[model samples]
Target chain A: MKKHILTGTLTALLTLGGLSVPALAGPEDVVVENAWSRASIGMNRPGAAYMTISNTGDEPVTLIGLATPLAMMPEIHETKTNAEGVSSMSPAGEIVIAPGESIALEPGGLHAMLMRLQEPMTEGDTFPLTLLFDDGGEVTVEVPILSIAARGPED
Target chain B: MQRRAILGYGAAGAGAVALMLFVGWWQVDGPGGPEPIGQRPVALTAMDFRLTDHEGNVVGPETLIGRPTMAFFGFTYCPDVCPTTLSDISGWLDDLGDEADEMNVVFITVDPERDTVETMAEYVGYFHPAIRGWTGPEEQIARVADGFRATYVRVPTESGDYTMNHTASVFLFAASGRFVTMIDYHEPREFAVPKIRRALEEETEGAT
Candidate 1:
């Protein structure tokens, strides 16, 4: 009787383990690469984040939203230069990436405007950025903060 | 015939009024508009200015006018635009070689509240050795920006914080203190090198 009871309990434990593994949601097929941002100056100062988003799979993806714990609000902003070379910055909605392609968000183009820092960002410090996609994919990327005038991570 | 004459006079009077309005608008709003980018469309009459540099010494038109000078208006907090432009300027100076000595690059802060003299000094040093940075009273900075016909507006964010939208063009002045031309905000070195070489050559030609 004792041997039979132990076998039944072992079977039940294996079944529960199989069920719990599927409960954890995995990140959808998307890759975020080379994320970096300039360090903010003070509490009320605004800093910018730049990165390259690649759609590695055959299916296209659209980036819908961005959130960060470091800033009060994070949104997509594009800097446009007119034919006369006058630049204007405004909020950009969503950006779509085709299959096997990537979109680079850099200066004078699409970028993430991190607004109103909760605290000063120091060099070498990093923060978490959650990128929301149309495929119900949420990818968290670690963006390392560089100096006040850092053009890129290599700098 | 009387009605025809009245109509003709009325049309001519209306045309005259339209022409007058366009001229008035162009003077304050068109040619000298808030943000004049690219090679300056017209030669801007240089205005004399008195302000301090990073060294705390008083610098004015009297001190700065004698050499070929380049003035850029931007804030320190500007990560991408300002640094990219400054880096490009550094490249221009590097391309100038010894001709660089004849030209001076100065960075003036549009956001004076944060871009103190110390800030400007540190920021400018990152690019090139000869670059100078300046900041002063808000009115003084405005006067200098106005003198160049540049525009900079404060843009408020969602959290009541603000960022600056400033004129990113680089202004070039001749040794005569007259506006020579503006190197479009981010003109490549190939495009900028020739224009700057010609300007430097002209200074030499004028001196001889």
Candidate 2:
């Protein structure tokens, strides 16, 4: 509720401020917005990336995997909390985005899990992450590293 | 003779009724009456386990005594919830100002195989200075988790590696080592800080 309003307002304000969003690469029909990640606590620990991927084309697209130099292994993982409040993570296999549909990989849910980071992801830093699709399409987006406690990109 | 036997049975039945009423009243209103609803007295110190802190110091339940303690369970490999919760705790400690010194904020790792003492030291250093990370033998971790009423499981992922599924709530304890309440995952700062304050308040009340 409030988060949606805040995000919408932030997007509107950013548009009004004349700040352009990150440029979409490869297939322009697939839009990636709010690509963001948190600073890692240590170089040895893992980090995460989140964003909303919208497929505006006439056909469905499957997100196959992710690639980044920041970490040794970057894969799509889904964090699930059961009824007992025990949270777990598992590899999220290729996610299919239907036409005119959007898939959001957010905190406490589906996200790009970066394992064994080469260096600590510090605040105020940016990195390039390539998202691969099953159709031989790829999209590279610039992910801004925010504070470790940041809940969203705008935060 | 039959009437006398009947009278004796009736008298015994009356005595039994009186005894039940007395026992029921004693449980409800006696000197050692039942605790108020939702107030279950839990002694956290009763859990006996030993583990080394990030600083390589062997610590047990005794270390938690004499301070309001906050403990959470997770793995260092965890990317989202663990770091987010730790950062949130750091913010709470910042809001506490000088009062934070009197608290014990601990992060216990369920994945002892990966989270060594050195790993924990570097990990906790990123958060509040007051935070301490604890890791030990897998059996000891299990013992501590059992005592804290927490749970965790090792889940194998596709990359020939594994992840942990663990309890996500932060447990609070009073200075006397009595279990307080829990702060759920992603709980807002407004509610989380007050819970910590209440644990501190318990110490004040106990002092006098």
Candidate 3:
């Protein structure tokens, strides 16, 4: 009974406080670089996060999940534009990263879609994000918020 | 004998239809066919329609005329395309150097349900300083969309959430509010910058 109560309290606090998860633990094969998100305009607005994901491991790995406390829901999505210049977004599932290959989650392409934003991603703010791998390994890291108009870090 | 006669008539009818179609196509093609995408301005002159700008001012097509304009249709909820296209426009404006002052870019929301005037202001605030966002009642927005031949719809997802899928092209207009051409979404800086320069020149030429 005591354990259940403690866990419940912790979950509630995490959700209410918008607590970012603790830093990633040891032994991560996937290196996440330059994880950043553009500042959202208002509360409850949607936002996007981008980063470069590199696979240093010898074997291939597939990304299966993502989580963030800043958003009520997080999803992996990709935007595609046709020849006629119409754009559509679709859920991207199981993105496989080949060994020695790097995949970019950038603007106008694959991205982490943050829905029902719980907090404003203001400039100079930072948040925690967790990525789950199909092999049961997870990477938790800090995403430094950038200006809303930023096209890249240089901007 | 009757079957043979019927067959002959059918062949004659088919020949007649084929000749008519060839003549019709020759008339429509007009020598070298229709003009290229970036050349002729189609005069897509937008009809006057009321809309609330990000600055809370009531505006219409007439309010935006007399300047080289680029009309873009999108929503704030768009994650990748909208921001990317906005960034793309910013780059073109940057390349335009001092001439950028003579151009106007308008962002009209197709998802007015969520994109209020306040939100529209906040969203466009991220792009180039010259870009402005507009939003209004659904019927008014629909009229403007019809004027530009743009399309957008709220698409429902499997998870019960929704997204706004919209035309991603940037509609270019001359100083006279005549439709010039378009810079398709994700168009390379090299392709868009030249066309923009020419359009600005056209605006200047028309002015003097």
* Chain A TM-score values for every predicted structure, listed in order: 0.79, 0.86, 0.81
**Candidate 2 structure quality by residue, lDDT tens digits, B79-173:** 98788778788889999999999999999999999999999998888789999999999999999887877789998765567888998888899
lDDT of each: 0.72, 0.84, 0.78
- lDDT leaderboard ranking: 2, 3, 1
Clashing pairs in 1: none
Name the regions of candidate 1 deviating beyond 4 angstroms: A1-28, A42-44, A124-126, B1-45, B94-99
Candidate 2 local Cα displacement, residue A140, angstroms: 1.5
TM-score of chain B of 1: 0.77
Docking class of 2: acceptable
CAPRI quality of model 1: acceptable
Clashing pairs in 2: none
Off by over 4 Å in 2: A1-22, A40-44, A55-61, A97-102, A116-124, A134-136, A147-151, B1-42
The ten-residue window of minimal lDDT in model 2 chain B covers B34-43
Candidate 1 C-alpha lDDT tens digits along A48-94? 88888777778788899888888888888887666654556777888
Q: Write the per-residue lDDT of candidate 3 for residues B2-64, one digit (tens) a residue.
A: 999999999999999999888888767756454432343345454868999999999888876
User: Taking the tens digit of each residue's C-alpha lDDT, what string does model 2 give over A53-133?
Assistant: 999899998999988889888999888876555788888999999999999998888999998788899897777788899
Q: Kindly list the per-residue Cα lDDT of model 1 for residues B1-208, writing each as its tens digit.
A: 9999999999999999999889888876878445534335223234656677887878766566568777888887765677667767777887788889888678889888988888777667667787888888889887887677677888875656566787777877777666777777656669888877766766776688
Q: Rank the candidates by TM-score, best first.
A: 3, 2, 1
Which candidate leads the pack in lDDT? 2
